[model samples]
Target: MDLIIRKYGGTSVGSIEKIKKIAQKTKDDINNNKKILIVVSAMGNSTDELLEKANQISKSPNQRELDLLMSSGEIISSTLLSMALQEIGVQSKSLTGFQAGIDTNTIYGQAEIQSINNDRIINEIKKGNTLVIAGFQGFNENLEITTLGRGGSDTTAVAIAASLKASVCEIYTDVKGIYTADPRIVKNAKKLDFLAYEDMLELANFGAKMHPRSIELGMYYKIPLIIKSSNDQEDGTLVCNSKDIKNLINKGIIMNNITENRNRVSGVTSEGNISKITLKNIPDKPGIAAKVFEPLSVSGINVDVIVQNISNKNKTDLTFTIDDKDFDKTIKTLEKESLKIKYESIMSGKDYGKISIIGSGIQNAPGYAAKFFDTLSKINVNIEMITTSDIRITCLIKNDDLDKALIKVHEVFELDK
Candidate 1:
């Protein structure tokens, strides 16, 4: 019998009726002789509500306690859904992340799953019961409760599917499936029937709703996934191995990231939290480049888009970007080395956006960069920071102009009709 892992997001089990609907789906799968494992998220904004409640109680909730509190939402949903399954004559059980043997690192608010020992789950499934597992939260080496960050539930589902070697992991969400563009933003945007894990990563990284990190986990284990709607029976996008995408090109989607109205490039993506610090008045020598960033490097700040230019007779401007989440701590750590590097000043902003145009055919075309910039030029969107890989070109732009810029570039690139 093939093991089928179905992961339902919050909206899928938000009410008794919705749970009943899911039970019907489960019964169909069971009748087909498919052993089942179900993963579930907190119901209908429960996690968000829990976060809001935590904020109301404390300005800075302890990370460990926060994980403990937030995990309950998923527990609630899993148990309720399990109850619904039994009400319909299906044998079912709900297990917490720990009970299901999800072992992770010690990180309280952002733990990564280290391993999954599925002994207990296997025993239960062998006894003719469908197992419903809670998502997002996990247990550490010392058995401490931990939580995975935003969209971690998706990661949880993929991880379980991989561990059990399930035929496919089904992710039920609010939409029919992954679209070329957000349907709400672009009415004509079409859904992708299939997508490569790498392409899905680019789409998710470039602002698509699907979680990129979960896609990464799926790729690691060569697990196939179907992203479908919880409210209906519409087929969802399938994410699978490279072999599954062998004969495909032009995968029915294009994205354009434009920041400002200057028009240097199209589909530029930028994150504003990255502060660029230029250490000035340093000796204009080759090795001098290493002096400024040494402290940030030691502090483990991953810098992006580094640029150095000779400013005068004996000095140069050094600029780079780091994640905004770590911006404050990085700056605090750098203060100690200010005198060593003789840095002039530091500038930071959280009002930037990262824009990119993602497509499989991009790497095959020559002069693609020129064509991209030309399209942006016609639209007058300004470019801030630029980065690229063989398949993607990303730029940073102002947050205020992001919407108009994205739409114009998408149209310019013929991403939508």
Candidate 2:
């Protein structure tokens, strides 16, 4: 039987009614003779509520215990969904990540999946039982429970699909599909029918609908991933490598024969809660860069969009962006290492967010950049820090102007058509 891997996000399985709806969908899949294995996230806000309860007990809970406590949310979801499936006359079984043979590294909060043994999963499927595995978690080498950080459920789903060699991975979320811009913000934002893996990777990296690691897993495994809506049976979006793209690209893009917007760019994505930290007046030297960033790296804080000013008088300034969640931790870590790094002072701000446009052949074609900047210029939004890959251009702007800038850019790039 051809196997299919489907993952439902927390919002998709938020209520008993929603779970029943999903069960019905599963029944339809089975009726069509496709072997479907599901991965499920915790019910909506359950993980956050659990974290809040833990915070009520202690400001800094033990990492190991925190992972153990947080993992229960997904277990609850998996079990509940399995019960729903059974009640609806679908034979199904729920398994924790470990029970499904997912093993990870020792990191408690953000463990990396090391391997997955397909023996139990295969056996359960062979017995005609659909497997519903808890997402976002696994066990470490020491057999301790570990969570996969923020986007862990997506990671779990994709990793499992890759490990089991499933035909394709479907990510069912609240949104209809990947859009030209967030449909909530840009009213005219159009849904993209297909995306190259590289383009999607850029989007994921710059705060699109996906987690970078999950997209990376999909790209590396060569698994075709579809992002679809759980609330309706809409053709959401297909993300795959270029070779598998349907039809041929005419005029730098193709969108299932949609001719209104034919451009190299795919989408506009935005993110808030950005914090930029600058180490001012650092002694311009060979190893200063390492000294500045090494501490943040060791602390597992993600730093993005780095900039180094020109050296003058044997001193220079270094700036980088990170998610504001790590602001306090980043400050403390840098302050602790300030003397060693020998920076004059630290300047930080929480007033910034990023807006980005991602697509294909951006560097090779200069018009995209000119148009992007011109669009922002017209809105009078000042760009702070700028970062780019061949397929993406990201600009940090004042949070106040983020919405207008994103919408204007969407219109300017013709992504709304």
Candidate 3:
């Protein structure tokens, strides 16, 4: 029998009735002679509510206690789902990530999975029982409960699929699947039947809710996934292990999620609430840049969009993107480098938005950039910044004009049609 791994998001198992529907689905799979493993997120918004409650009690809650508290949401859902399955006369067992042996690092909020043992899961499957797993949370080396941060359930499902070598991992969400653009933004946006890992990664990074880290796990394990709406039978998009799909001409219409009035060179995406650290003068020496960023690297603060301007009179300006979440840590790390480099100033603003338009055709079309800018110029939109890659173009625009910018740029490329 083929092994099947299915994951239901919070909305999918939000209530007892919904849990019953899930249990029935699992029973259907079992009756069809498939070995089943189901991973489920907490009931709708339960985790968020829990966090809100925690924040109510404490301005800064202890990470370990918060992890333990947050994990209970999923644990409750898993057990409820299991009970629901039993009520339907289907044999099933509920498992937490720890019980399932998903060993992870000690990071309390955003722990990374080190490995997953499948012995217990495999045995349950052999016994003709469907296994229900609490997703998103795992246990650390200290055996303390820890969570894998936002979209962690998606990551959990993929990680479990990898461990068990399941045929395919199914992601049941509110939407049918990946669309040409977010359906909310583009009503006529078509649903994509398939996508490559890289495109999905880009889409996820650009506000697609499917989550980039889960896609990363799927790619690493070469696992195929179906992103479908939990409420329907519509055949959702299948993300597969095929480079062939990425090669198809105009395989998908990727939307640039930015708004501006005037057309510029290309699309732009910028994260405001981002900081820029300029290490000036650094003796105009080699290894200086490396020395400045090495501490940041160790602290795991991801630096994005690095730019080094030409040194005027043997002085340079360095700018990189680190969001508000890491802003405090980034400043702390830079303090250590203060002795080595005398910089002008550390600056940040929460006044910008990152906008990007992604497609594979840009590299071959020499005039695409000019056309993009001309369109913006015609509309009187002023661009703040711009960046490009072989297949994509991005820009920074005023957050207020983001919607107008996206629609106009989308229209310029005839992306909507």
Candidate 4:
């Protein structure tokens, strides 16, 4: 039998009522004679709640213990889902990450999945059982449990799908597929029916709802993923290769986008809670940046949008941005190596946000950058820093102006149309 991988996010199975509905949906799929492997995240905000509890106990809870505590949230949802399935007269069983044979590296909080031994999963499928496997948490080399951090469940679902070589992976979330701009912020943001993996990856990296890592896995594995709302009947968006079968269903959605002008720019995205840090008066020598950032690299802090001022008197200023959560960690890391880095001063601020335009080769094409800059200028939004890739153009600006900036740029490009 052909196998399908269906992943329900935390909100999708948050309550008893929703879990029962999911149980019914599973029954419907089984009635159609299709086998499914269900992957699930923790219910509602249980993971956050658990983390809050850990914080109450100790400000710095041990990483291994924290992983242990957080894994319980997913375990609760998976077991409840399996019980609901069984109560509805369906043959189903719940499995934790270890039970599901997901092996990862030694990292406790953000472990990378090394491999997945799906022998047990295959056996369960052979016995006509629908397995409700917990997402996010997995085992390390020594059998210690680990959790994949931030968007971990989505990563887990895609990784499992790739390992099984399943037909497709369906990710059910609260949103009705991907949008041209954030619907909550921009009321008229359009729902995309399909997207090229590259376009989706850029959008997600900038500010789209789905995680970039999940999109990356799908792109690398050539796995077709459907992202849709679990709460309603809205159509889902499929992310896959542009040359995939979607061209047959919606031939012009991506192919003739530029010529038709319906979607001149594929989407606009904005991300807040960013902190920009600048190291002033450093020697303008090669490898100076490497020396300064190596500690942060070792600490796994993601740095973006590096800008170096021209050398004056053989000294230059270096600036970069990172997520707000890592602001203190990065500051301390730099300070600890202050003598080695030999910088004059540290300047940092938390009032920054990034606004980006994403599409198929929009960055490479002329005039898109001009249109973006012009639109922001009319709104009095000053661009602090700018970065570009083959398909994305990003601008760092004041956090307060992100909403207005996104709307104006979306309108300028006619993405809502």
lDDT of 3 by residue, 8-82 (tens): 999999999999998898788678676778999999999999999999999889999999999999999999999
TM-score of each: 0.84, 0.95, 0.85, 0.95
Better of 3 and 4 by lDDT: 4
Quote the lDDT for 28 in model 4: 91
- After superposing candidate 1, which stretches have Cα over 4 Å from the reference? 245-342
Clashes of each: 19, 0, 22, 0
After superposing candidate 2 on the true structure, give the runs of residues whose Cα lies further than 4 Å from its correct spot: 245-262
User: Model 4 over residues 1-417: C-alpha lDDT tens digits?
Assistant: 556788999999899899999999989978977678899999999999999999999999999999999999999999999999999899999999999999999987889899999999888988878999999989998999999998889998999999998767889999999999999999999888778898999988888878898999999998888888898766578788756645434532123221212364788999999999999999899889999899998888989788899899999999999999999999999999999889999999997999999888674578988888999999999999998888888999999999999888888888877
Please, what are the lDDT tens digits per residue for candidate 1 over residues 143-234? 88898877888989999898888777888988987766566655666676666777777777777766777899888888877788988766
Worst 10 residues of 3 by lDDT: 253-262
Provide the RMSD of all predictions against the true structure, rounded to 1 decimal.
6.2, 3.3, 5.8, 3.0
Q: What is the C-alpha lDDT of each candidate?
A: 0.74, 0.88, 0.75, 0.88
**Candidate 4: lDDT of 42?**
98
Candidate 1's TM-score reads 0.84
Question: Model 1, residue 306: displacement in angstroms?
Answer: 6.0
